[model samples]
Target: MTTSKKHGSNTALVHSDYQAPEGFAAFPVGIHHASTVLFKNVAAMRERSWQNKSAYTYGLHGTPTSFTLEARLAEIEQGEHCLLVPSGLAAITLVDMAFLQSGDDVLIPDNAYNPNRELGDWLARSFGISARYYDPMIGAGISDLIRDNTRLIWAEAPGSVTMEVPDIPAICDAAHAKGVLVALDNTWSAGVAFPAFDYGVDIIMQALTKYQSGGSDVLMGAVITRDQTLNARLQAAHMRLGFGVGMDDAYLVLRNLPTLKLRFDAHDASARKVAAWLQTRPEISKVLHPALAECPGHEIWKRDFTGAGGLFSVLFDARYTEEQTDRFVDALQLFKIGFSWGGAHSLCVPYRIKQMRQHWSHDGILVRFNIGLEDAEDLINDITQALESLDA
Candidate 1:
């Protein structure tokens, strides 16, 4: 006989013919923060190998918290599997380490994040692997750079500080034709503005420390892949490296995921407003924002990306000296001078293009601006005042 319990007009089923075993009920979030998981018996422990997702043997392999975070991230990127790493750069390294072998070559965009480019150089020197730089605007022409030993191709849409949007689909198609895997540093778009997987990328790497945390306090990265085999390889590499993150940081990123869309939209609107204003300024020579119609690769940006983010750079008119550029950055009252953006507060950083590029030409000094959630008018006023200070 089955009996049902009712409370407050809601009925609950209590079947006498059925029984729920111990720990059968599901926890709401499954916040299992543990280094070692206990098993019911020796047989269960031996059967619980680290190969499968449900079986957890060690914390570095995964805890319930990390697993939950991975699942949520995979959903966010529309990936089949996801692996979390210590930092965004670590995610990049994991992908490289997972695929490339000694004497193999990896193609990197010339305008890629500096740290990533540096890592490639280091990997070449240390691991006997080779790294080559290709123009960010290579498109289908990237086929020219492919060698028999080329194993991986790295893509960064709207290339780092210069913001040159690439023909991602064309590049991906070309890379895949050669049986080379493509990995994108999707930090700028935060997976919300651009769907990396939809464009035929095998792996999507994001710095959760940036938009995902939204607070700038945590440093976290995620490698998301739709290919199960690639995911397993990345996971195995991650395990060999002893990659693990704090449970609190995972919880913080999870908490912020709900508001990612809202924050991203706000950032996009503010950045577009600011970039538009800078385009008309006398002191500004060029604004390297892909969303701006005048910016290079604007057409490709329009074709590929859904929206933009708050990070953009402005090249000062050739008339302004480096000291003048420094003064302008120092004159800003609201914008903080710092490195690494995607935080709640506005930031400004000066750049020297001669140091950042190998083949690109620079007309003047450049300053990267990270627009925050402040009022657009107020932010504009701050910039106007800074430009005025440049004149003074």
Candidate 2:
């Protein structure tokens, strides 16, 4: 049976025809775990040797299941191509490895995911490449940091810990003017919240382990690009590094992709409610959420992004001590203290900005919150009790 019309969102879910046909029965496009793929002939083998996104010769190159996931992700990002990696950090590293060489410079926001920033610093020390930290709110002012050797600029919206939303379009415009490539760690927005390619980002990287998987089980990342040339280069780098995600992980993300928009909207609503409630607490200094009117980059986020996600941060009043913060966290029955968000269960982590940055400083104790799918009333009650614990 051939599907002629364009499949709608629900149609895609109902139609299990995404797989190829076998002799008598249709094999569902399940997990295709492979390291070495067999070719039809020597001619086909020679043709498949090159990593051009067509035929797969090796497992590290890609399997049919991986290709399907990549295609679906590219469609979601509205990009010309997409490449999968073992993890989100691997995706960041692949972008750095593919674009930067010895003596080249890359610009990273001070509020970037700590791992990416650390990787850049390590690369600078080990590979002779240099990475300079810029303020997340710099916007077009990033031009001042661009050097002749600058090859790439990394941007993260609603940056980690601080939750400051950057002026992504302004940064992209400035970077493109200098012929320097712009790559965004778009895990916060999950591609559904904000379309990076539409905003002029040459390369878009996402950690599927977060919102894309919707569960805390899978670890995956993707590098999407609108430029075919840049895509080719990234694919070559991915191939060389043998960076490939598990077929099961790919299947999990693919299954979750159908409900991504709905989940994102739910997260946005729940997060706004929680952030607003946190603001009313006397012990809370500020609520760092992009969708909120008082956030650092509310105007920019309003102008660029279509929505927000579950991730946001809160600063406690200066009067609160570390012991108080610990007591509050320990009192929470619903919010688990853990790393990584975009999962089904809510989580909270107290962070020290002084340790995370060199150029920036915040005086109050900051706690990042990840709102989950639980009832908003329950979450609110949990917070209320947790805050009460702080007072007692």
Candidate 3:
């Protein structure tokens, strides 16, 4: 009489009675894989809102895994709200689509990350939005470029390969004065070296592909904002774009978060050492490390940044041709030739700066370095040998 109704083998398999103990704990966040979430009752389902992240409505909105990562990233970046995207470029596009509309004008730095610049051009070409490029060094002078329809300004602290650090606070001040929002590609700093919001950046975009993952494996990005209203706009765009990050990737980033600052400092120490040595080299015309006096906006960098990441660029001696630089890059043993940085393996990339920028005043071949976790002396020896290839 008292026994529960027996179910068939198939039904038993589909709906298991077993449940794991509730008190178990672990260091890593549980990887929650779910496309559809169940509710205790119909009333609970009716009350659920995807926008209110306190509860989950669907997998696309987020699971505990993604939400945990988002909260940690927001805390690191000093933002109140955060949204994860598929990639760093996706984060830029999300910001653009969220804020700018038809007849809106946006200002972009000439030396911005190539993908970002390309996205701006595409928006201008297809959408009714107007995207204009401005000098990265314009600073407060940016005020003159703002139009009545200008809605957003994109700033990169140090221009990508060319590495010209801009006056961010001044730019933010100018943009805010015009009631325009400033979005910063803070990927270079990895939220470890720089506090973006403290300096007045309204929106902070990070390429988690770099230091956050630190494994050269995951591709992810985050958009963070302190203003709830602004975050609401971003949430709408995020939903419309169907942006969903893998819970597995989310866990990967979470696993690496504890060592972020430590790794960043190690990279900083090695990079500065390598950059300083390069400055004394006969083959290098200029080292574009922000810590060095030769870099543009070095003073601003000193005033604003607490530290620098492993990334920096070097301009070869004008005497060395592109062929020679290519030879040198090809000969490197420890440093792999590739794009994107922040892994344990050193990387070198050569950029055609003049072609990428509207007004690139630099004269030599621009080569960027991402100093890895290797010993600086060993890396220097590798570079020393590679430099000999320039002669052949």
Maximum-lDDT candidate:
3
Give per-residue CA lDDT, model 1, range 1-392, as digits (tens).
45544333333432243465676664346466888787889999989877688878987778878888899988988888999999999999999989988999999999999999999999899999999999898899999899999999999987778888989999999999999989999999988888889998989999998888999899999999998899889978998888889888898888888888899889889999999989998888899999987777899889878889889998999999999999999999999998777778999999887797888787989899999889989999999888887878
Best first by TM-score, ranked = 3, 2, 1
Q: How would you encode candidate 3's per-residue C-alpha lDDT over 76-159 as one tens digit per residue?
A: 998999999999999999999999999999999998999998999899999989999999999999999999999999999887
Candidate 2, run of 10 with poorest lDDT:
19-28
Per-candidate Cα RMSD to the true structure, in Å, reads 7.0, 7.9, 1.8
Kindly give the number of clashing pairs for every candidate: 0, 0, 0
For candidate 1, report its TM-score: 0.92
Cα error, candidate 3, residue 4 (Å): 7.9
> Highest TM-score, which number?
3
**Decoy 3 TM-score against native:** 0.98
Which ranges in model 1 have alpha carbons more than 4 Å from their true place? Answer: 1-30
**lDDT score, candidate 3:** 0.94
lDDT of each: 0.88, 0.88, 0.94
Q: Cα RMSD for candidate 1?
A: 7.0
Candidate 2 lDDT, tens digit per residue, 178-270? 989999999998988788888888899999999999999998899999887898799789878878778888989988988898998898899
